[model samples]
Target: MSLVKESREELNLIPQVMHSLINACVGMFASAYHQAENKKQNLLRTDILTEQFKRLLLRHIRTHKSTSDYAESLNISPAYLNEAVKLTTGFTVGFWIQQATITEAKRLLYTTDTTVKEIAYLLGFTDHAYFSRYFSNAAGHSPTEFRLTHRK
Candidate 1:
């Protein structure tokens, strides 16, 4: 019966307090895990969409250059496709499409003896001048300059 000593009732209540604390800790951990899982799922879905877009671009690049065209083929809205691309690549849909087109143009320039006008037409560019401007803007030089510098 010392003042410092705990009674049987107090000792019984100590286990109850510990159990509540453990439950609270578990609940917090569970909530944190759930949030992390949701973020991972969102990232996975964005990555899948980005991969699909890239495959479609590579296969039908000459025919389908517009963001809306690619999005429509993929059964998604253009805005959503853009959002997913931005999330995965930190670039807009138009930027990716433009880059893909330029990459193909460069490949054709380097690998084939095709003239700039013919290459532009092959890439579905209606105007060779517009293609030249676009190439200069993106590649920092005209297609001729790129071909000369890269030619073996």
Candidate 2:
């Protein structure tokens, strides 16, 4: 009887978790589409486009880290992407990608018990050492150190 109850609880939990995940995914897609539309509504609105790009980049940085990839997704030329991002934000698209990657890495480090290598991989980094260097360059500390200092 106790085993049956436990099985029921486990089964209920799975659907709840799946429901939450599905909702989150739907929210993310909605946000991305909204950002893309804002960019399209005004070609001269480079600042708005750049801001929208940042939102999109933050949501998809793990999968789309390259400027050219983002450009292609937006149906724009790489040079145009770079120009708009730089003109409005004073930073290139690559810079935004690096910043977004580093931000996500920090969030994962502080929020999860993942190892540095795992966090690097989670952030779409191909090489752990390269991630370490990148983090150190932008964050002023290594991933392990940042995790240790910021962990609550």
Candidate 3:
């Protein structure tokens, strides 16, 4: 009789225990899914910021040459801007700025009849000599040399 009573109690507890385990597993899965969603949202936000930064840099590259200027415009810290840009593009803000400047300088040198000094001034350089040095360092040739080689 006692054995029969104990068996009945054990049988009643089994379904409750199983239900508790199922609830626990469902909770864990839900938590994990939310976390993954949050991570995806964060990544999307960072990507948007990076794209905006690039656009701002291109638009204002001649007038604003520093990362801090873009950062200020975006209302973010310079360090955060650099980190996001680097994470998305595998390069720093300064690298992109230098590349843009050099590419524009090369374009001006190759296409127009603008003198090197005038080109330098147009690109916001205060001194043409420093611009020539900067162009040579990034482009592997001075502005005049590049023009002579690339021009017909």
Candidate 4:
């Protein structure tokens, strides 16, 4: 008779113990899930900022040549903009700006018969000599050289 009563008591305690264990497991899972969600949201926000920065760069590459310029337009700090862009695209903001400038310069050089000085001015460079040096450094050739070699 004592053994039967003890067994009944143990059986009654099992439900309470199981309920506590289940609640703990649920709490842990919920915490992990919320953490994952927050991380995903942060990454998504960074990606959006990166895309916005790229669009601004393309639209204002000729006029806005500085990282601060684009960062200001996007309402973000230059450091944060660069960090977000670098994280999402694996490159800095200045790199994309330079690429946009050089790509446009190349297109104009290849397709038009504009003088190098005129091309430099069109690209928002105040000095043709400086433009030439910049182009040479980024493109591995002078503007005139690129035109001559690339133009058939």
Candidate 5:
């Protein structure tokens, strides 16, 4: 039957039947709407999470050696957090971590006469050669070449 016929099936159909259905639907909709509002009030944005990730990363760069360890401290899978970091901040988690590492590398290069090998270990590279390669790729100059050219 058509919806109109179905609703009128009791044969006493008039304003009362229409009123009951409208009220029922409105009640359920109101309950769902309020639940959604409450959820919105309770949750933080992904951007806030990204900011927290940056702060934790800076702390780790100062004190630790690994992104894997940092992600563990934040209680999230590194891969999942990396994806969120990319989406919200327009940079991979690795990208920021690498930037922080490279920044420190640059600081030590310019401000101190520390050997590149020493700076590499201080920044947590397992091998001096690998640090040289990684630093060259990131800064577009070998660590020594960069220091020679850029230092004041």
Candidate 6:
């Protein structure tokens, strides 16, 4: 074997493991650098998302409406709302809306003895399949699985 192979054999690690470890280290370093940049940007523009987030949270928790509705309520275009949300939360307006709705759905599924259809409509999804699809996409499981996990 070569010197490199000998060194790796001494450490009981394969060449692939060494490459993977180096890649993981680089990934972690890049993540930390990006996080620091994000922190600096947030410090420079604190609460810039407060109004929009507040409006979003209120309209969402209260009514769980669509992004277009929220953007119209805020009197800006949907694109602008999406941009604001991305700047504020690292997510688009639609993402937050869908995720928030799914979160509420999870809460109901885990805490209440409610039917999936009822919870679906309660969270503003006109159809149960739509709610199920959205919930599964966000939680990596179906609402029934979620409920089963948390059943009392």
Q: Please list the residue runs of candidate 1 whose C-alpha ends up more than 4 Å from where it truly belongs after superposition.
A: 1-43
lDDT of 6 by residue, 38-128 (tens): 8867662324543666566756663746667776776777777777777766877677776677777888888888999999888777889
Better of 1 and 6 by TM-score: 1
In lDDT terms, how accurate is model 6?
Answer: 0.76
Q: lDDT tens digits, residues 1-152, model 4?
A: 99999999999999999999999999999999999998877777779999898888888878998889988998989999999999998999899989999999999999999998999999899999999999999999999999999886
Ten-residue region with minimum lDDT total, candidate 4: 38-47
Name the weakest run of 10 consecutive residues (lDDT summed) in model 3: 39-48
lDDT of 5 by residue, 1-152 (tens): 69878777766666688999999999999999999999867765566668778888777785555557666887878787777788897988878888998999999999999999999988888799999999999999999999899874
**Tens-digit lDDT track for model 2 on 8-122?**
9999899899999999999999999999997777667577667778788977888887888888877788888899999987889998898889888989998889999998888
TM for every model, in the order presented, reads: 0.70, 0.67, 0.71, 0.71, 0.67, 0.62
lDDT of 4 at 9: 100
The Cα local distance difference test for each model comes to: 0.93, 0.88, 0.92, 0.92, 0.84, 0.76
lDDT of 1 at 25: 100
Give residue 143's error in model 1 in angstroms. Answer: 0.4
In candidate 6, what residue range of length 10 has the lowest lDDT sum? Answer: 44-53
What is the lDDT for 30 in model 1?
100
lDDT for model 4 comes to 0.92
Model 5 spans > 4 angstroms off: 1-43, 62-66
